[model samples]
Target: MRYLFAEYVFDTDRRELHRGADVVSVAPQVFDLIDYLIRNRERVVSKDDLIKTIWNGRSVSDAALTTRLNAARVAIGDSGDEQRFIKTLQRKGFRFVGAVREAKEPAEAIVADDQVEVQKVDLALPDRPSIAVLPFENMSGEPEQEYFAEGMVEEIITALSRFKSLFVIARHSTFTFKGKAVDIKEIGRRLGVRYVLEGSVRKASGKVRIAGQLIDAVTGAHLWAERFERDLADVFALQDEVAVAVVSAIQPKMIQTEIEVATRRRPENLTAYDLFLRSMQQYYLTTRESLAEAIRLAHCALDLDPRFGSAAALAGDCHASNVALGYTNDPQFDRKEAVRLARLALRIGDDDPDILSRVAVILAGMVGDSEAEIELADRAVALNPNSWRTWNNRGWVYTMAGLPEEAILSFERAIRMSPVDPLLHMTFLGIAHALIALRRFDEAIVALKRALRHNPSFLPACRGLASAFAHLGRDVEARAAAARVLEIDPSFTISAHIARSPKSPKLFIEGLRKAGLPE
Candidate 1:
């Protein structure tokens, strides 16, 4: 998004301030302050708002705040005395008084009412996630409901566009086929999107029903579909719910499709994304062999693209997983390597929520830096609140940091975001850990059972149930759970588990000991 005002273009996407044909040098804080003021130009912005936003809620001196504000003024060729572009209301707040207009991203534009312009061209799919939300058919016989259906598609498009991972095509391009009977695959080709969402909205007697489905454009397959019915009161709220539901479902489905495509690709045709996807598929299996293979694939991805932060972060996470699962023979070496890869990922992948989330968990568990890692975890969530993987990784980070209560909340949010995500069993295991830490054995047992139901061979969940049952004094059930663990992994031992999972709470290990597990 670019803001145009007074011979200056503030390019928010590129984080640049340009004047006509020249680039303007400005500090990061100054840029943020300017951007905030311009975005909220219709209202006043208090000092408290600036401090909370720019300083991340840290207190800042009045003098320091003034310095940053003044720097912003100079960058845009305005002055405190002139106050032409920015206005400071004494004892009140600041506002961007300048006239400002926003320009949509190039090749994207909104459609005006009663306007429909078809476009024709061949386009290549972008490297990142991309989608086109075609205007929904207004199945209602009433012409007024046409507005509702169009507005709902716009809401969904805006919601999806918020995630940094997605590339949403302009509404102008999509609305051309608004009333036309068109093929989904052809729309996908013209818009160059991997996925497309289409649906119909019906409004009658003060109630609205919407049905939406996401399609894998490449394979012409239905990836997800849902129906929603809501009251007409608070129409915006209903639209928001529909958007959230659709966005949440679309995200995980798109990634799963991509992962499957990558896994099926020939080795010689593998790109960095394919290797990374392959690694993620292996990483989630959570078995010793799979985790090792995930690590190998991650390293192979790094070899192809050393600056691939997601790949590097995945490698670091695999190391942490190895230590947690008792798969690594050299604990110290794994720790050191995890730390190294985490830092490298932090450097190269600062803008990516996935990398930040993975590195946060690795550092929280291995480096033992709870405060900093928690902040990093929060940053990841802040970067992309809609991403379930970030929230899931936050759960593990908080669990390892010994903040079990927070861990459970993060895990639950992740499941709510994408209930059928392939990594959902891992999230259930996280919830079980948090419950055990809280000494809620019954709840822990319930969570473990859920995890096992999802993946019966999931050793961690089985082991968790054994420990939880033992602590609850259900000796027979505890022994059965222990026997099941052994059945799953014949070489299991409490001593090795303790050595590998150094971050495990003492109570959990003690429960395992009481369960009569081999040591």
Candidate 2:
């Protein structure tokens, strides 16, 4: 792949940089950095992201990173001050601001074999985990079942798209493969996804049978396969059921597979969707460093596709998390920026439950916009009631609004829907926080402990535990919890926390003050 920008041509296949017939002598790391920045020019690249990509996640000092970035700029006839090609964003990262065009390699005919090599595709893979649902094969004798099969595949695509975690190809793109014989490996390569879902829809008499298989597109390994037999009377309902079952069955598989692949590639080779998936994987850690990296990755995704609502929502989410957990001392600036991102996401993805839920949680929890948060939360629930994230977000809004009863109910519903969710720690923390508002110190302590058990480093749980323990007169435990909070986020101060948490009631704030957090 060749990228041309300004007077330079970067040959990714040759691993060379050229400017007006002059080959630039760049260090391996510098070349990788420039390549990454150019390939992902759609977003900002952070120092942490640089270390992860160029140094393979090794520790690198700020001065060293700055020097290397400077070297990269010099090699490309650019500089930090000039920023003709690379622009820096304060408290964010760096973006390749130069206009670029990708030159495609000539396409070759794809061979359908066990060892498949796909011809180059025009579209790049997304930064998030992506899957293409090929149009379901119509196996029934009657050709009239074509719409039934197409409808089922389209429904599945729509259902999968609701998951902020997975990137689902649109029906129009996937349907292009309808009635065609294609190689799974080629499909995987062309789609730039690790997994693919394919199935057959059969309607016989009054009954319907849907058989689906989830394949690891990279290795042609069958991760899962399922068949459902249901009444054909309610076609849409059956489609919904099959879609839900496929998503539930394959979600865990996709996560595990992505984790294995996460460390195998550099940013230069990743698509916008791949970057988004990487961001989400890191975001789940919920640590200060991880949040920074996640935010940077999310921004990179947005750069590749600025209108991506999920990426915008996650970017806002990271900003909100930064202030909510006291990761930053500058609450006002972070709050303003976070609200701006959330508003953009809301406008772009008004109907997307994933975006709506994230925006609602951030606006309600960090910005303290009760009306907007509540309305969005309600809309998210109505859009996808089965989504645990939607329920979890709604609970957050209620907790922030000081409605303990409603908050507790919403959290419980979220837990019921996704009992083993990695983020269950968050729901437990919400219940604990709400319990504190209700003056149930003992119950709150138990819930906080449970949350800590799931994720010991979760700062919100630690802070809540401290408050609950103090309210219960367990001074020793309270001090221990407060110490843990400091350990996770040394910048944490009661004043900063209070400023960010606009929805917290007076009683809840009082408990934290009693718990020995510095004002």
TM-score of each candidate structure, all chains considered together: 0.76, 0.61
TM-score of 1: 0.76
lDDT of 1 at 21: 44
In candidate 2, what are the lDDT values of residues 151-248, reduced to their tens digit?
88877776666665566655644665677898888777665566789999888879999999999877999988989999988888887777767665
* TM-score of structure candidate 2: 0.61
RMSD of each: 10.5, 14.1
- In candidate 1, which residue ranges exceed 4 Å CA deviation? 1-119
Error of 2 at 126 (Å): 6.7
Candidate 1 residue 344 C-alpha distance from true site, Å: 1.5
Task: List candidate 2 stretches off by more than 4 Å.
Answer: 1-158, 161-194, 197-213, 222-246, 252-263, 487-493
Q: How much is the lDDT of residue 463 in candidate 1?
A: 91
CA lDDT, every model vs. true structure = 0.82, 0.77
**Tens-digit lDDT track of model 1 for 1-519:** 887654456888889886534568999889999989988887879999889888999979999999999999889867665455676765667878664667764523321223343322335676556788999999998898888898899888766765655666656557767789888888777666789999999987889999999997877989888999888998888888888788888887887787888888888987777888899999878888898898889898899878677889999999987887667889888988898999988877576777889899899888788999888999989877777888999999899888899999999999988898887888999999999999999999999999988888888888998999999999999999999989987888987887777778999998898898998
